[model samples]
Target: MRLRNKPWAKEEMSKYPHIVIPNPKECKGNWNKVFGNNQPIYVEVGTGKGQFLSGMGKLYPNINFIGIEKYDSVLVTALERIKETKQENVKFLNEDVENLLEFFADNEIERLFINFTDPWPKKRHEKRRLTSEGFLRLYEQVLKPGGDIHFKTDNQGLFEYSLHSFSKYGMILNNVSLDLHQSDIEGNVMTEYEEKFSKKNMRIYRCEAVYRD
Candidate 1:
């Protein structure tokens, strides 16, 4: 996916310090203070346009939703969406996935969502995939025991690789769906990419991988 340069993105993002967290790393273990409540926090990596997080926040008002996106251009759009929704429980971090641990401490996050992430398909780029072992280890450190990662993608090879990766890491998989839209799963929030892919009749793969103690 090509990202068009939005020269005003950075300047626009600064306007909403409440929605776009300026210093996420400083909040680390004190995310409850940031949200001013003890509600469980759910994070979405590579949150493009903030559609999923916004929708989830509306459905689950008791849960705090944080979105992490590296690109200022992409993240600005998500920030705008959250502002329009006026969702107090929804926030964003304009940060990289590699620095995930820096923003949250052990057992801080309750759940994670990885939806339609870039499928770095080259064998050489396997480590860059969000479902790769390195990322799984990072997730394990931050999420509470029994926390689950909900993942969805339209890429078949990446889906297969992720299933194998999850099993290799000893994570228990559940609710695996090769065609999510056709499945019986309820309350599934659609991301911008998921909606576009569904319109094209593409199969959406989804699964939940739980972390064990």
Candidate 2:
């Protein structure tokens, strides 16, 4: 399903008013100005409810973060989360990820994050999955060469499918974890979905995919 419009809903965030982008279109190819001189920009493509990005922005002040969500209703929740922190290092785009090239210059984004994206389980609907080859091409356009996309999901099927898709695109994978919560990495930020499904004993698969030059 395509997402509708409502830039004001997010634009009106008052608490962490700094997080709200005055004009997202202006940041196009000029994101560096938002983060000061030169800082790494990390993007969360489907930042549902903003739990992860908000927490991450608070934790890493030097790294600039942007959340891209097509759905306005869901993005409002994330906007509200950042409100509590007043983190200036965070921003968002209430737009589809398909227009990534328009929002950013080639090789602009340093890192990408895909967290518990819609699986698009049906074989006929495979193209709808964010990890599809066509979508991966869009990622490559915005992601800096040698840059990486980190993915986390509780769906085994999507993880398996994404693993194949990454390989098909000649991307390199490392630090792949079948069960993320069980790993030794401390202080891992958990999203609302990750916290909910993990209690049900579902295995969480995570991996970092680096696009080859």
TM-scores for every candidate against the unseen true structure:
0.99, 0.90
Per-residue lDDT of candidate 1, residues 140-212 (tens digit): 9999999999999999999999999999999999999999999999999999999999999999999999988
lDDT of each: 0.95, 0.84
Colliding residue pairs in candidate 1: none
Those runs of model 1 whose alpha carbons end farther than 4 Å from true positions after fitting are none
Residue 186 error, candidate 2, Å: 4.4
Worst 10 residues of 2 by lDDT: 9-18
Count clashes in each candidate, considering only residues at least 3 apart in sequence or on different chains: 0, 0
